[model samples]
Target: MTRRTWPLRAWTLVALAGVLLLSACGEGRQSVLNPSGRDALLLYDLARVMFVGALVLWLLVGGLFVYVTRINPREMSRRLAEGLIVGGGVLFPVVLLGGLLVYSLPLMQAPREADEGLRVHITAEQWWWRVEYELPDGGRVTSANELRLPVGARTGLVLNAHRVIHAFWVPALGGKADMIPGRETYLSLLPEAAGTYRGQCAEFCGASHALMAFETVAMAPADFEAWLAAEAQDAAAPQGEDATRGAQVFAREGCGGCHTVRGTQAVGQVGPDLTHVGSRLSLGAGILGVEAPDFASWIAHTETLKPEVAMPSYDHLPPDDLTALAAYLGGLE
Candidate 1:
């Protein structure tokens, strides 16, 4: 090869290798390869088998190339060529794929979650998830941007979208399902460990589709029960001077028109329920911290941070009112 061309090719290979190495370096629990649940493990195993089978096929082709070019460069008999074509090419692929189909299809089925367990209904909006827990008692608690599941239990999920289609996927837990408009899709994830995992909208819905994400927290059974009980309760009253003023600002600005806070008159269904917003892991559909400052920035820069969102930017609010509003919302826990 020419020297100049060789250097360019070498650089390309180096870049590819760098990317491959970097992709393996992840600390987050959002990888199917590092599965945290049963269905995810099944998927991982099936993928491994498929990958290994494909690798063997490729290696066989490479060996054929070496045999024909280097070991013995001679024309084969027509009879031998036809036999290779029929046996190795046609029959081999049929058997391989048929075996794979037989083995892998059953691994894809989700087991029954439970005879009596909590059910989660998730509705996908343009760029956020509206999460609701259907209690065994028939009452439902509304939440957003975060999902909590009890470890060692299969929790059933009913997913749908508001206006457009979206896909729900938690890589470390299980496969994805499409969330269609006016149609419900079902999935069940049984987490084996108590840890935090990340989930995202896998389908391209609109402008901020890539930014649509949520946190999944697999908790111990007792802790999950307590948290669910707390979630069903009304939001705690805002405390402190700033928080009280913030509540007033929230009312004055008519923020309740799109959001909801259970204990107050701020009941609106257009946006997420803010009854316990402060207790959430993140804000703005899991894109920002739940801290007071994060809330302040979101109130001021909604359009800037998330384009085409339903919530209008409240950048016109005065600085004091904004701060107070942030304080009040942050104290909703």
Candidate 2:
């Protein structure tokens, strides 16, 4: 190729790569820019305004620098210099900053207003989330790894930590609130659309902190009500010989000491509630999908998927027993 053509081709490749990289940031379900809730949309709007304001400020500064360096000092008047100093350096910044503070302070306080809709309690552990929903009858339903909400409902989340500090953040929903030990914090979200969003622990807690993620599903009012009803019920009885045998294995393996499944003898409260484990979209705090193969793998090698996790590996179990156990858990839906 000719030299001119080669330079053109190189520029084209660089432009293409830049476009591709920018596209990746726009496509994720967890991106704050693609907000789906009222608070998130407000934050997104503020971000856009600030971004544009920064660009304008940069251009003005650059222009001033160019004029100063290119023009002769003798040609510039003393009044012009003083005007630039006061206007650009002091008054301009103070006005801009004051306006921003005024605009954002109210948004920060909006979440603190009373919420009359659903209330959820989320407790952050080393690498997982314990989710509890307050029912209308004053009872509570507990679950893990997945959070469900009604679209267009103002849901209040009461957040706390079981051990160390963590941050509960779902970018598409709203801003994050810290989950601190010995203290309870709150965040309010009003999802505007029905879709699935991803959430993660924004603060680092331990070795598996990066894997401490969950899914947030926003459904219609009717669908959300039905889901709540099902979740409030006890786990269904295991069917068939394989599933029955698997339930027996689960009890014999001492899995009941850390986990709980309603309507069963397993009543341990140290781990995530597994009453509807099969109904969850993902397993192990969003590390893997809820499927037969993934379930078996998680059971056989918990540490391999999540390092420094509290659960022990059950690789010593025979292949048949493992398969049966996986089958039984997968049928809990």
lDDT tens per residue, model 2, 41-150: 98988888777776677667755765575433346688988998899988887887787778878887766665988999999987899999998888999999889999
Task: Report the alpha-carbon TM-score of model 2 versus the true structure.
Answer: 0.91
Residue-wise lDDT of candidate 1 within 179-202, one digit each (tens)?
Answer: 999998888899998899999999
What does each candidate score in C-alpha RMSD?
3.6, 4.3
Stretches off by above 4 angstroms in model 2 are 1-21, 71-79
Give Cα-based local distance difference scores for all models. 0.88, 0.88
Error of 1 at 313 (Å): 0.9
TM-score of each: 0.92, 0.91
Q: Which structure among the candidates has the greatest lDDT?
A: 2
